[model samples]
Target: MKRPERMARLARAQRALAEVAKAESIAANARYEDSARQADEILDALNATNVLHGFAVKAMADTLRRNGRTTERLRRVADERASQYVRQERTAEVLEERATQASSEARRKEERQRIEILVSSPRRR
Candidate 1:
């Protein structure tokens, strides 16, 4: 090939490689953003549920107090509410963990794809 022609080809290849790299980076970043959005949604839902639970518990406590309930009954209600709260917390933890795992997997997959593309590209002699 003529010198100018070879240089042009090299430049074209370099541009293509840069474009591909940029696309891959954008895709990976998009995936990360989507995962973060999902996590935020889950957290918001958990917070809303927790707030509702708190409101319900408070209402019940207020009602009991207004009705002149005994200490034993109040204690039992508090215990039950505590147990329920613990269960909800456990569920939130599981959901958060799953979200993190999914994000990690997505990142790994993106890395592998980038590596494969790099390795498969034709190298100039």
Candidate 2:
């Protein structure tokens, strides 16, 4: 694809990566809140159902930990993709610069050849 299009895609990918990290953080926080609520419920039910409350709290805590780890993994993936896109953008820009330089050089060479031909050719009397 063209350099400008690649640049645009790179910007969008960077933005999306930031957004993914933010959203995962929010989700992880929500999981923590839910775990806290479960702990509170367990306390409230301590006298009436100690055994079941303990099990419920344990399960909720485990789930929260797993959710946090999953979010971290997902965030890492997003960061990797962002870096890949950045590399792609740099490559595209480099190629575009080279192409522009090559075109300029070609034009200069053509102009020089034209001048040489004109100078060497015999003029009409």
Query: Candidate 2's residue-wise lDDT over 18-101, tens digit each?
Result: 566566556656655665565565445544555566667666666656666665665666566556656655665665566666
The true-versus-predicted C-alpha distance at residue 75 of model 2, in Å, is 1.3
For residues 1-125, write the lDDT of model 1, one tens digit per residue.
Answer: 64444444555555555555555555555555554555455445445655466656655555445434343444455455555555555555555555556667767888999999999999989
lDDT: worst 10-residue window of model 1: 66-75
- Number of clashes found in candidate 1: 0
Q: Which prediction has the highest lDDT against the true structure? A: 2
TM per model? 0.42, 0.55
Worst 10 residues of 2 by lDDT: 42-51
**Root-mean-square deviation per candidate:** 22.2, 8.3
Which regions of candidate 1 are displaced past 4 Å? Answer: 1-69
Error of 1 at 39 (Å): 46
User: Relative to the unseen true structure, what is the C-alpha lDDT of residue 47 in candidate 2, on a scale of 0 to 100?
Assistant: 43
